[model samples]
Target chain A: MDEKTRRQALKAATLGAAAALASPVAAQMGGSKAQPGGKQDPRSKYPKPPFKSQSQPWPGLASKMNPRPDHGDTSYVGSGRLTGRKALITGGDSGMGRAAAIAFAREGADVAINYLPEEEPDAREVVELIRQAGRKAVALPGDIRTAAFCKDLVAKALAGLGGLDILVCNAARQQSIPSILDVTDEEFDRTMKTNIYAPFWIIRAAVPHLDPGSAIIGTASEQAYNPDGDLYAYAQTKAATMNYVKSLAKQLGPKGIRVNGVAPGPIWTPLQVSGGASQGKLVTFGATAPLGRPGQPAELAGIYVRLAEDDGSYTTGNIYGAGGGQGQP
Target chain B: MRLPLRVLTAGGAALALVAPAFAQGPGSQRTREFVSASAQSDQFEIDEAVTALAQSENPDVRGFATRMIEDHRKTSQALADAVSRSKLAAPPPGIGGDQSMFLSALQSARGSEFDRLYARQQVLAHHAALVTVEVYAASGDDPNLRAVAADTSALIQSHSAMADQLAAKMEEGQARP
Candidate 1:
């Protein structure tokens, strides 16, 4: 339908869902009842905010998240794409990594998740989800920015899964500097090391054992293109990541390995709540994208699945832009 | 490629429609169908890729394919209701011809051969997808479809940039003794 009609239809559907949830009869029939301000209770079918601000730097695990970051668990379906494969994903405690991990497990791939030590609780929950999906899950706690840690991580994956088929260099750190002049050297270095250099280190360490047909997918960003003034350093790092993926793709192509990247626009993930931006700023996300709303994690899961499976066999050394049209180019 | 004249003319007309903010009437079902059909076509490409990756034996290809499937599926579903309302036919399958041959080669091969074939295809696919999204966005009648097309076009551009970088890197790697 046209934009206007589509919008109207979406609005109508949303209202219908809300109304269905609000009716007492519907509630009696197992539907959730709406609370004040059109909000659902925290325990309701629709997530309710436990606190006024659900955006914290460390929102912790999905289970513990107050209102919870929407990861689209109910909507995602696995088609056995990664059956019998094994993967290692950094920052798998929550957000995009966690969503990817869940989808991977559902697809029959065993997973090894690495998270910061402080994020143990969140890591545990993701591990449980993997196990529940009947897939093996190894939770490794360490800092990925260190080369030593990266090496150890590879060793652990080898020991845990016997072999690794996929390496998702997806962890990242972001802090808004408002302007180039305001960017501190420490901040710039930290962002670069976390978002760019860390991936480089991990890939280097993992390369030795990666067999032909193994894949490496990096999590870049929409900021790599249409960067905002405030995210100069973060954007620069993400842009560098895309180049890194490109270079890696070519260097590894000879070895029968494929390298790629995913540049997500404004998807509501833990990164948005805790990475460094204020909650107020994040609430306006997706407004600027053509879709006019922030994307949920569930929305991103399918793309991750597509890239990690053979469906994209003819795809490599490429970047898939999942942004809501914010950085189309 | 230069912008199509049709887009430029359509853009002018759209601009006229936008001036008064509410002057123009809502789009017709046919217009909506056209836009929806265009979006469905993009989704179908993604779905096809997902289906292929799910059954792939190569881990690298499989991993990348998995992500594409997950992301594109969500986007496809997000547009489903709208596309359904329009009742338009989906875009023709696979962009066809030599591109199909190249894709098949990558899927069936392994090792260095696979990589080379895949890299070449990445460039071609992104370029083609970019053109498709751009033209549809600029000239399509449905505002939402145009918006989605424009958004996807930007993404394809990023892919193109990434492809260029990959091509150069592959060239450099090949040059090494």
Candidate 2:
């Protein structure tokens, strides 16, 4: 055989090997059990979670969910990724904010968590958990929509945590409007202020204090990319958030502060349960993604950690999609 | 005699043809089976959690729970596929071993009682899960498992707060009219 023919045959064999390795059935031929002495293996009986749908809103609170979402406890190991660093997370009472807070703590960063007055209990619990993890956690209660409040929040976080190395803009409120026509000007303004403008202010206030190598991460949404007519205002603001991340990355990159965004497909968080979307539309949430399911906050926690730490140092001006294949890469 | 000779020749050819399958890799079959099993186990737990949440009476809880279930389910499938290809054993189910009891207790309660019990269990479960994730992340050799564990740990921490909030709300609602 000619040299070219031999090379072609080798290439085909390599491709065939790779294809066999990539097959789904290849997974089944592996281990039959996860661990010894644990509960009976659950794979034989239960159906997997379905993919996310464009119309679904956030899934609220993780504790109440059945079978429970994976939250790293015994699995995450700290490598001092953020040793002596400080961070402030808005809407840190519960949900994605809380998850980010814990990840920061695990990485050796001190955190100051902000929540509304009514969400004090939720915020306090997270603060305690942070403390238990051997980090200092400060609980600040206020609304992020107010410029004065945002300023105060930054001040308090600086005072309590000393200085900020990372700023996670994660607080937002959502309400479902039947149509764009049904959305009141007031509602649209409110959503934008809370979701978009608040982050802008927080980043602005926090910028001067941020040192080189600092990072800023905004929690955008899958809705930003795939807009539903009903979520016009919320979706618009989220899109703005994405744009802000891109623009800010360019602006902040010069100062050694990286700006990025996390666009979650559909996550279970308090924002969803507390009227982010109308309850009437909650039941069939996360039903249409290619993966056949929505995602949990726990599932998303690692991406934020990676983004904040050195693991994602080279990554900026990028939006990490944790939406379970809902948004294509 | 001619027919017998032909049958023997056919048998010899068949053996020769199939010999490469057994010679492919040592312990490859076992490893693949293990990974597949582990993935399935993870999916089952995630799915069960979602279904339970969807059926919940509280609209708020149900909504949030449904999302968690969906996300976990998707990740679990990906993990399952990975495990199957790796030929590794699946992780065992019920890390703390009391999920059944908790589920049963939850099933027996009604109204606010059910909510309280469910929320409390979530907190406990997440706390335990966090520990498991931490250990796996630190010691597990598999990059995928470690990544999943690390990410899942952060999420569980968030869930712990949500569970506590729901529990508090349930208590408050019970106290009120």
Candidate 3:
């Protein structure tokens, strides 16, 4: 058998054995299970790519995806890790931001989410989910490309949530181009502004309001380390994201505020279907990972939860990765 | 039940507010303890708010009491359903000892005094309740109970913020002509 098939069979055998044996070791493997002894293997947990060649406008909607990206809508069971915390998340309508938003609300936090106005349909779904979780949800729809709006976004979030303790700068712009020659200055500037500049502005405005125990999380990517030629501009911004996370963590460490980053690899998000990946690449997306599948946004929910949780007081200047056995490149 | 002992301050007679304690550390709360505490907390809020709805002339205090009743009832029912599903025995009947004492203190007051006391008690009660749910949600033994705790935490938080604002407004009114 080929490596992928063999691995799948091995995983299936292990799962079956665990079910039959009901061993303590098997029980221990049930990470994040709603109940004990309810283990599900990670490899087969979510949708794999061989995705349809789909496209959306500049920003995409999670609701419209063929295999809707899971944002822990039902699967994530939060323990009151973030009770009474207030959060501000960019791109909270979809992807990692959406997953974090859902998780935060479930963990007992009031959340303010920002997205493009076009993403209202998706943002509305998130708002409803947050409210259903019984937390306050503030929806702020606007472009992050402008420094003015980014500053306003934090101010609005503070006003809406009544305070701020968690800030997740997860919104990003990625458009894969075959060559640098085809990359326009406007596209580069857009990527830089959305990925780098916006965080700079948002964090600047938010830091003054953040108390000692507050946390700031940035969504970096695997492309930061192993630069994809097509994602030249995007990759560099991710690297910048990682760099800033480290730099700021030190700067903020003494004040007791934590700064961290999540570097996701080959996760199935709206970013992919919306010009973030070429059609050919989209079909085989995440196939290169050792797991032979793309990841769902839900998989990274715990990492974000941990980074923001009070228990992670000692964990700062860190970049937690969920790259599906691909490691840090 | 013993009322929170009222003491005369240098400026005026003030109700020495006795803050309710959850009696459990963070992440170590048991399922039974969680259910019992949650049910009691909800009952305390609902019962006190019911009293406030009748006694308070201030619209803000009355409105807040109305919301507390509506929201706490939902959380109370949700906790009961979760307990039923788990086949855990029902939590002890009625509110806790401390809650009963505070309720008595609230009952003895009159007019604007009652409104101020109600607002203050709600803030303290919700703060304590927030901790109880948070501790259980973080490290409770039962998954379903934890989920309930987590979900309820947000509402408790919102209520806490509202109570703070209401208390501040009341203070402002008292200070002004």
Candidate 4:
């Protein structure tokens, strides 16, 4: 195309995207949702696909996301499944972490959340949601890549929430490098430190404080079983997490503490736009899922809440999947 | 890094873009400056890509050009949203500072000359963006902008590596007298 033609093409492309975005989302599939921050019916099916591929900066902002990934602000309908519990959720700023935070708080748990300093906006939002649940909420912002920070985060969570009955290693980082050669040293280390190392650090620090009946849920992924060729490091760490979760479940079971993993499929989250998936992959994300659309954060909150409560009293060493029928068991 | 918004998020010095606007009065101005600089870079790349698509027959250059247009458009929208929320002036559509000269040179070039020129800027711009976003991420006055800068820097670092490889290949092709 010539300059004039190319300019016209780009102009059309921009306008087209803007035009589509201008259309308002029809109220959630089953009807308009209750004012967010409160509960609605648990079975209300939210809208699917046609979500904006908007990316926020690192540790991306949930608020900025177009049609923001619903963090169970509505449609959760907590049933006091976890009354009087104290929980610490890393990466509770957004995505599954945010959803679980909301579920836990509404289920009657005092909550402490740790996330990257960059995610403070999201953490603040989560804190507000938790406070709305009539539960104590504290935001502990810092990097999870360092052991010192991980230990410090646990201490702060313990201090803020009084005692921690649920320790969720939910924070993670991933980048798609197609070729092994494209994986840089810094990139590899960051993936490891985030997806693997931080879990170890947080678990080690929290183990001493955890009593029997405490739940340690690590956010392993379906990638552990079905690895993506581009996400080499991420898949590797996720695989390792599956093993670690099982091993912890066995070890902690002797102490009445349960360890488990949740393998989420292509849940729509800031993680995708933040380089969790290659851009091309994002163009058709979650299409192959049994369900045509990607899973939302709200879908996973109930499971997290269950595992942390008496509902999961006997569930340990199991990898519960919210993977939309992809990786079962 | 929208400083005014960041300040509001940080719960201090709300939107006070007073005189000495560029000074460190809680980072709103600095955030605006960062956003403007980033917008300038995005526009420069988009213009260069448009030139490449129009003039270059090389499939590689065209592909890279397509990517630049798409990537910049998405990011620009986000930045535009930030600009709107910040109530800051939207940056004019052009290159910043001496970058206009590069855009001019790109507009006039053709064939391998255009290829070489485009790739060189890609290399340089990617590197500059990597550094700029990294600096802002590390110590930018605003917390929110710092996150954007950090995310953008990671992306730029990836793009820079690709541009570096392309620059080397284009330079090799240019050597064939």
In Å, residue B45's CA in model 3 sits off its true spot by 66
Q: Model 2: which docking level applies? A: incorrect
Identify the candidate with maximal DockQ: 2
lDDT of 1 by residue, A32-132 (tens): 32221353222233321112344554534555444455553333345467877899999888778888987787667899999888789878867876776
Alpha carbon lDDT of each predicted model: 0.64, 0.64, 0.81, 0.75
The full ranking of all candidates by lDDT, starting with the best, is 3, 4, 1, 2
Whichever of 1 and 3 has more lDDT, that candidate is: 3
Error of 4 at A104 (Å): 0.2
Evaluate every candidate with DockQ and list the scores.
0.01, 0.03, 0.01, 0.01
Q: Estimate each model's TM-score.
A: 0.56, 0.55, 0.59, 0.59
Q: What is the lDDT of residue A111 in candidate 2?
A: 92
Q: Rate residue B114 of model 2 by lDDT.
A: 48
Between candidates 1 and 4, the lDDT winner: 4
Kept native contacts, fraction for each prediction: 0.00, 0.02, 0.00, 0.00
Worst 10 residues of 1 chain B by lDDT: B92-101
- Mark the 10 consecutive residues where model 4 chain A has the least summed lDDT: A14-23
Root-mean-square deviation of candidate 1: 21.2
Error of 4 at B8 (Å): 71
User: Comparing 2 and 4 by TM-score, which wins?
Assistant: 4
